[model samples]
Target: MTKFILTAFNPANGQRARLHYDNATSELTSESGESLVQAVEVVARANAPAVSKQTPLAKSSPRVLKISLGLSCNYACEYCSQRFVPRADETNPGDVQAFVDGLDSWVTSPPEKVEFWGGEPLVYIKTMRPLAEAIRSKFPNAELSVITNGSLLNDEINDWLDRMGFSVGISHDGPGQPVRGPDPLQDPEQRAAIMALYARLAPQRRISFNAMVNRENASRAAIQRFFIELTGDPAVPIGEGSFVDAYDEGGIAHSLRPGELHAYRNLAFHEIRTGQAANVQAVSSKTASFVNSIRSRRPASSLGQKCGMDKTESIAVDLRGNVLTCQNVSAASTAPNGQPHHIGHVSDLAAVKLNTATHWSKRENCPSCPMLQICQGSCMFLEGPLWDRSCDNAFSDAVPIFAAGIEFLTGLVPFHIEGELRDDRKDIFGFSEQVKPSRDRPPRVFPIPVVAA
Candidate 1:
C-alpha cells in the first residue's frame, strides 16, 4: 500500500501537525491527538479516491565536513575573502592527518557530506586524492563534492574525481577584470585552462558553476548571453549567481552603485526566465502545457527559495582543522586567534549543535522574514555583525536573481512533474524585499574590534 505524509505548520500555536494516510482503504490518522484519527477519517472520506501515507519531510542534514586543504590559491580574484595564494609553508601533514582522522570518526557516527574547499582545492591534489579514496572506501554512502576556482583542474584531477565518484562545482565570474590586488584578470592562461578542463569534464561529472555577480560585472545582457551559451542543454542544470560584496580583509574593495544593482537584477531575472523557457521546450509538449498552467496560477510570492549552502545542509572546514558552520563563516574569519581550534569534528553531534546555534543566533533577523525557509537567512558571515553592516543586503540582492530562477523552472514544471523531479529542481529562487540600505544602517562589523597584540 502506498503512503502519503501530510505536514502542516499551525501558525496559531506555533506547532506542527502530522497525519498519515493508508492507500488501501483510504484511511487517515493523526500521529498526535486521539481525535486525529477521526479528523483524518473525515478528511479521507471527503477527499475520497486515494489515501497516502503522511511522511514527514526529511529535515536537511546539518552535517557538513569542510576539509580546508590549506590556504592556497592560484587566482587572485579581487573579492576573495581568504586572501589566498599558493603557499608551500602552509600545508602541514599533521593537520591533514588529524582532519582525516576526525572526519573518519564523524562519518562513523552521524555520517555527513564532505566538501573540499580552499584557496583552491586542486592545489593539494595529492592530499585530496588519498582523502577522497579513503572516504569513498569507508563511507560508501556519504555524499562528496568540491568547490574550486577550476584554475588548476587537469585531466588527472578529473580522472580522480570520476574514479572516486565526486561532484564538482567551479567558480568563475563570467568576464570582468577587477584588479585582484596587483595582477589584473587572474592569469589568462589559467582561465583558458579552466574552460578547457570544464569542457572535457562536463560530460562525465556533475559539474556546476558559481558566478559571483558584482557591480563591475553586472552587465545583464552579457551575463544572460553567457548563461544561455553555458547551459544550452535543457538536461544540464544552469549555473548559479551569488551577489558578492566587494571587499576583503583590507577593506571595501568596491561597492555596487545603485544603477549597477538595478541592471544586475534585471539581467539575473532575464537569465532565469529564458533558461526555464528553453528547458521546457526541450521536454514534451504536454508537459510544457502543464508548466504554463502552473505559472499562470501560482503567485510569484508562492514560489519557494533556492537551495543554497545552508548550515543544516552543509558546512566547511578551514585549512587548519577548525570546522566552521558554513562557507561564508569560514571565509569571514581566520581560525580564531590563528590557533585553528577544532570547532567540531564532522561526526560529532557537538559540531552540529555549535554550527546550528551559531547559525540561529546569527540569523536573529531571519525569523521575521517571509522568505526565511528559502533564504535560511543567507550566509551568516555575509549578514550579522560579521561582514556587511546591513542585515538585508545579502537577501535583497539575491531576491531578484532567485525569483527569476523560480519563474524559469516553474515555467517548465509541467513537463517534468510526472517523472522524478531532478535534484537540480530544488535549486529554485525566491527572496524577500525587506532590506535597508547599508549607508543608513548602524555599523555592526564582525571580527570584533581587538587591540593589537
Candidate 2:
C-alpha cells in the first residue's frame, strides 16, 4: 500500500494535523496529534459506495436517458460547453412519432429520468413539445427535465410545461450578463414570461435558475444573491455551479487566469462555510462526497468520471436513434482524442461500442491526484489544450471542497498534498511554503512556485 503525508488545518479552531494516508486502500492510519482521535469517528461512518458496476455497451440498459433535439440555439454564450461541437443532422417535429415508436423496442426498461437537450431546447419548440409529449406518455412517471434560456418562454408555453410536469432549468449568468452575450431578463416580454413560469413551478420544486462559474462570473455568493434579489425569494435553488469547461478560444478566454486559483478557492470555501452559496449543488454535493470518502476510506480506484458518460447505462441519443458519447457533444462531432462521439444507433444496441471516452483510470495524472475523488477527471473526451485548460479549472474548483471536507472530518484543512503526485500539485490551494519534508528522509529543495493558468 502506498503511503503519503497530508497536512491540514481546522478552520473552526485553527487546529492542525499531519496525517498518514494510504492510497492503494484508502485510510487515514494516524495523525500527529492524539487530540484528533475522537473526532475521527466521522470517517468511520461515511461508508460511501464504490463506483457503479461497469457493463459492456452492447448489454447495458440505461436508466438515465438524454434526447438531443439539435444543436440550434438563439443566443451565443461565450463559454457554452457546446460552442465548438460539430453539428449533426437536424431532427424536426415530424421525427418525434418515429422516435417514440422506436423507444418501446430500443429501451429495455423505463428510464427513471429523461432529459430533453438542445443548444437551447426551446429553440426547437416544435420538436421539443411533440417529443416530450410522447416520452411522457410512454414513461408516465419518469422525471422529465429541460434546460432553456428564458428568452422564448410565454404564458402559452409556460402553461403547457406545467401541464407536462416538467422540471425546467433557465440558463442565465445573472450578474455576468455581458460575458454571456445577452440578458433575457432585460427584455420586458421575456422577463414577464420567465416570472410567470417561475411562479408556476416554484412550489413544485420544478424550476431553478441554472448558472455556471467562469473567470468573469467567479462568485457563487454574488450569483446567488442576484437571483434571490431578482426573484424576491431568499431560498432560491441554483444548479450547475461547477466551473466552465474550456472548449475553444471563447471558452479559454473565460477560464481561470494565472495565480487566481488560490483566490477562487479561498472565496469559494468562505462562501460555502457561511451558507451564502448553500443553494449550489456543486459545492454542497462535492463537500459531502469528499468528506464521506475520507470517513469511508474510499480508494482512488473506486472513483469514476465527473460526468458519468463512461457508464454504459448513462446514454444520450438523438430522435434519429444515433447514440452519442454524452449530451454536451453531438453525434457529428469528433472527440479531441481523435475518436468519433457517435457510438452506434439505438436500432442496433448490441453492436454499439463506446470508443470515444477515456475513463479516469486511463488518464495519466488522475490516479495520483489528491482531488481524484472531487475532480474525477474533467471531460472524458477532451484532449490537447482543451483538456489542459479544463484540468486547470477542475483543480481550482475542487481544492476548496477538498480543504472543507478535511476540516469537517478531522478539523484539518489540507494546505498541501505530498506523495506520488507531481511536485507542482503537492501544494494545495497554492500554500507551497507550508509543506515540510518528513524527518526520516532528506528534504529536496523545491523550485519557485509556478501559478497555474
Candidate 3:
C-alpha cells in the first residue's frame, strides 16, 4: 500500500492543490484526507498477478491465438522487433495442413480472436491462405486480424482478406516511412494495392493504419492527421501510436533519449488535450483505463504485461507446431534473459512452461512507478540496455495520458508526482516553476512530405 504526494493545478484558474495517492488501492485524496474519487461499480484489482521467469505461467487453449507465419519481411522497418531475432526454419504451404490438423489436440476450444503474423504474413500468402481458411472454417465466429506493411497486397489477396472477416492493420510510419529501407508507397503498383485493400476494408470498420512513435517521428497528432487526410475520413482509426520497444541497436537509436522526455511529454499533452490525437488508440485507451483504475481502486498487482502475452489465455506459435513466447520471436531464437523462445511444443500442451518473460511485478521501479498502471512495464521479454531504453520511451509516452486522466477526474492538471522515482520523472511536463501557461502553445513540427501519390 504505497502512497505518493502530488502537486496539481487547475488549468482553468491556476489554483493549486496537494493530493495523496495509494497505488495499491487506486485511491486519490485531498491533503485534508477527503477522497477525491468514488470507486466505480467493478471488481477490485487489489494485487497484480505474479508470474516470473522462476514462477512462470503455463499455456493451454488460448483466447487469443497468434500464428507466426515466419520472419521473412519484404521491407525492413528500422526498429522492427522481429528484425534481429533468430529465424526458425521457414514455414511453407506444405506445412499448413499438418499444423491445422493438430490444432484441435491442444486448442481445447476456439479462440475468441485469431491473428496471422509475419515477417510479413503476405510473404507466405500461399501458406497463410490455407491456414487462415482452415481456421476460419473451424472457428467462423472468431475475430480474424493481421498487421501488414501493405507492400504485397494485390486484388486477389485483398479480396480474400475482406471475405475472411479480417481486421487489417497496415503498418506505415506516416512521414517517416524512409526508416523502412524501401518506400513501397513510392511504387505505383504497391501504393495502388494498399489503397485498394484499405478501400475494401474501411467500410466494415475493421481497417486501421498502424504507426509507431519514434524519436525522429514523434507526434501522435501529426500521425493522426496524416492518416485522416490520406483516407479522407475524419474518424479514421490509428493503431500502435505508442513508443516502440528497443529490440536491438536499430530500436535503441530511434528510442527516446533521456533529455528529450520533457519536451515530448509537453507536446504530447498539448496535442491530446487539443483533440488532435483523438483518433489514436494509445491515448484514448490509456487515459480511460487510468480513470477507471482510480474509480475501481485497481492495485498494481492485478496488472499484467502491456501486450497480455503473459496471460495463459494468449498463445503464440509457428507452422511446425513449436509454441513461442510471443508472435515476435521464433522457436530457434533465445530471449535476452537466456531462456529459449520455444517454450514448448503444441503436442505437449501440459508441459508448456513459459520461462522466457518477466511480468511487471517482477521488474524494479514498476511496483513504485506512478505510470505502472498506464505503461504496464513495457515489453515482457526485454532486458539490459534495450529494456532501459524501452522503459524510458514508455515513461515519456504515458506521462501525457496520466496528466490528462487526472485533469479529467479532478479538474487539476498534474505537474509533479513526488514518489519513489527518478527526480526528472517527477515532473509531468518540462516546467519546474509550477506556473500554469497563459495560453496553449503549439509544439514544433518537422516538415513532412505531401501525401504519397
Candidate 4:
C-alpha cells in the first residue's frame, strides 16, 4: 500500500503540478489547487463493470484453443523464447486424425478461436495442413489463426490459408530482420509469397506483421515505418510491441541493457505521444485499457498473466492431448519453479491440475506496482535473473504507457515519480533533476474526501 507523490507538467497551462498516487488502490489526486480524486471516484462508480471472474480450472472448457505443432522451425531467431526450450517428441500427421476425433468428445462447443503454433508453423505444413483441415471440417466457423516467419510460404500454401479462412501473422522483425536470421525478404521466392499473402489478407483485416521490441530493434516508430513501406500501407497493424521475455543466452543478450533504459523509455514515450506509433497495438490498446481501467477502477486482483495462459478457458495442447502451461513451453519442458509445464492430458480434463504457474498475488512486488494493470505478470513461471531482467524490461517498456495514460486522462505529462517504490524507478523522464513544482501555492481549503476501496 505504498502511496507516492508524482510531479508532472500540465500541457494546457505549462504549469508544474504534483499528484498523489496510491499503489494499493490506484487512486490519483492533484496536489495543485485543483483535485482529481473526486472526479476519479465519480468515474469509478459510474463506469466500473461487475468484475469478470475467471472460470475455475477444474470446470473449464476450451474457448480459445492453441495447438502447438512442435518446436521445429526453419529460422533461428536470436531472442525467441522457444529457441532453447527442451522439445517433446514430435507429433506427426499420423496423430492428426485421432486428435481431431478426440476433440468431438471433449470440446462440447466449437472454440471461438483456434490457434496453430510452431517455431515456424510452416515447417510442419504436412502435419498442419491435415490437422487444420480436420478442425475446419469439425468447426467450420471457428476463427483459425497461425503465426509463421514467412520463409516457407508459397502460392499453394497461401491458397490453402486463404481457403481455410485463417488469419495469418507473419512474424517478421521488419527493420531488424538480420538479427532474427536470414532475411526471407531477400529470397525472391519467399518475398513473393509473403507479399501475395499480405495482399490477400491485409484487405480483409486478417494479417499483421508481428514485431517484438528488443535492444537491437527498440524503436516502434522505426518498426512501423518498415512495415508501412513493405506493405505499401500507412496503417499496417503491428502486434507484440512489448519487450521480449528472456529465455536463454540469446534472449538475455537481446534484452534491454541497463544503460539504455532511460533512452528507450524517452523514445518510446515520445513516439506514443506524437502518434508516430499509433498503428502498433501494444501502445494503442494499452493506452485505451489504462484509461478505461481508471474510469472503471479495475482492481489489480482482476488482472491475469499477460499471455492469458492462466485463464482456464484459454488452453494450449499438443497433438497427443498434453496440455501445457503455455504455447512457449513444451510438455517435456519445466518451468523455473521446478514444476512440469505439462499440467495434464486433455483426455482427462477433470484430473488437470495447473500447479506450474504462480498467480501474481504470490509475487510481492506486483500488487504495489503501478504497471501491474499494463504488464499483469509477464512469464508466470520465470524466476532468477531471467525474472529480474524480464521485470526490468517490462518496467521500462511500460513507463511510456504509464506517462501516456496519465497524460491522456489528466492533461498532465508525468516527468518524475516520488514514491515508496524502487529507487531506480522513482524518476520518470528525468523530472527529478528538473525544477520542482510550486509547493508554495496555498493548499486548497476543500479536500476531496477519501473513498474507501
Choose the strongest candidate by TM-score: 3
User: Which one wins by TM-score: 3 or 4?
Assistant: 3
User: lDDT tens string, model 3, 310-422?
Assistant: 88889999989999999999999998889999999999989998898888788887778888889988999998899988999998899888888887889877777887888
Stretches off by above 4 angstroms in model 4 are 32-59, 437-453
Clashing pairs in 2: 9-412, 9-413, 43-295
In candidate 4, what are the lDDT values of residues 1-453, reduced to their tens digit? 466687777665566777876654566776643446334443322211111112124425789999999999878878888887999999898999889889966798889999999888888999999999989988888999999888899999999999999999888888987887778899999999999999999989999998888899988899999999988999999987888888778878988887788778888988888888898989999888877666566666566777777777888999999988888889999888777888888888888767777666667687667777788777777888898888888988888998889888788777778765687887766545545555685322221111111
**Which residue runs of candidate 1 sit more than 4 Å off their true CA positions?**
1-63, 84-104, 109-112, 177-196, 227-238, 245-253, 259-263, 274-315, 318-321, 327-374, 382-392, 401-453
Candidate 1 lDDT, tens digit per residue, 1-453? 233343322323323344443322323345452323221111111211110011111113336655667666666667776653223245554455666576544344544677776667788787777777776776677778887776676666767776676777766554543433322125676556555555655687467555555556654335435545754633443244445543344224344443344444444445444443232211123223223322333222222212233323444555454455444344334332232223454445443322222232233444333223234334333433334422333444543433433224322111011112222221222111122113354432222111111
List TM-score per model, in order.
0.57, 0.89, 0.94, 0.91
Q: lDDT rank, highest first?
A: 3, 4, 2, 1
TM-score of 1: 0.57
Alpha-carbon RMSD, each predicted model: 15.5, 5.0, 5.0, 6.0
For candidate 2, the 10 contiguous residues with the lowest summed lDDT are 44-53
Q: Please say which candidate is ahead in TM-score: 1 or 3.
A: 3
lDDT (CA) for every model shown?
0.43, 0.78, 0.84, 0.80
User: In candidate 1, where is summed lDDT lowest over 10 consecutive residues?
Assistant: 48-57
lDDT of 2 by residue, 12-48 (tens): 5544457776654556545553333232343223322
After TM-score superposition, the amount by which residue 96's alpha carbon in candidate 2 deviates from its true location, in angstroms, is 1.0
